[model samples]
Target: KRVGEDLNRHVTTDGSKAEWDAQDVGLMNQVNFDESTMPIPLCSCTGVPRQCYKWGNGGWQSSCCTTTLSLYPLPQMPNKRHARMGGRKMSGSVFTRLLSRLAADGHDLSIPLDLKNYWAKHGTNRYITIK
Candidate 1:
């Protein structure tokens, strides 16, 4: 059975921090007519022609088309999280797993992620919320 008064209460989505207008949204969808080059400031590409990408791997990489970067490791989890992968991290593929289950409420960890209780009992600005 479903539980908790918090779960029963209605909640609205938080205000967007970007607060983009129509013009700002359109800026992202602009068509690039030139295949040989991209516009300045918008693209700092050094990798491929006709690429509209901004910067690659903090400006050190050639293009977004190729990547040698590995993302930071996943949040702490219980044992056997990646049993099939032999304890090695799955890199950027956390969401790429085809399995039906991936994460949990984190109530049992040193850093619990129960969201509701994740914790009013502990603190704010947790790792998951960081950019």
Candidate 2:
């Protein structure tokens, strides 16, 4: 959720680059088959240690990662039209950066391209203009 929302990696506090390993992300980060998200601490920031990335959240998950639904407040299966996410035009956006990292990690992105909308309907948003 944080990644899709463009938040920093290992981000303890919201909207900051502060990297922390403590399980203090509150209730928002945890989910079933979390390994699917590959939440490894791939950082080499000034204060972070290299060895720290070797472990944490490690285990074997038999759960079908994609079949698993979302987290908290309201959990539901992905929409029926659920398909891979793609960018209209690639740039330095967080979405692209995440995709880049995934690709760099040797992920097979075969035919993983599609055009899509660029709008959002955030939960905190209340003013949806009606036509």
Candidate 3:
């Protein structure tokens, strides 16, 4: 029940734009190491060194080492289509989360740092906006 044909897609970073396959094809696993368990970027979450919790009013709170279910959507189904869409989005988000962490950590040392040196870099830049 897959829809249209897959097309080559790419997002320009820095200044260069290269073609990339739309499908993941298990690339994340190939690139991931033993320390790549964390999925979420910010806000306390499991797989990382932070703990999070959901509040009664509808917000996330940090605990110590608890697995917080904040903002995580339960599996919903009206039909197969909805489920497929949800799964696709979730997987896509996870892939993005991994890429972001890798990029931030400068683990893929092939690309040169644009604005600052990777050796002296630490922590997330809150003001940095990605196109």
- Number of the top-ranking candidate, with lDDT as the measure: 3
For candidate 2, report its TM-score.
0.22
Q: How close is every model to the real structure, measured as TM-score?
A: 0.15, 0.22, 0.20
Ranking by lDDT: 3, 2, 1
**Cα lDDT listed for each candidate:** 0.21, 0.27, 0.30
Measured by TM-score, the strongest candidate is 2
**Please, what are the lDDT tens digits per residue for candidate 2 over residues 1-131?**
64478554544664333432332433343322233453422212222322111111332111111122221212222442332222112122333333444455565444232212111112221111111
lDDT of 2: 0.27
Clashes of each: 0, 0, 0
lDDT of 3 by residue, 32-126 (tens): 32224543223322333332333223222233211213233323334543331111111333334345455555665343212111111122111
Off by over 4 Å in 2: 1-92, 111-122, 126-131
Model 1 per-residue lDDT at 4: 47
RMSD of 2: 18.8
In angstroms, what RMSD does candidate 3 have relative to the true structure?
16.0
> Least accurate stretch of 10 residues (summed lDDT) in model 1?
112-121
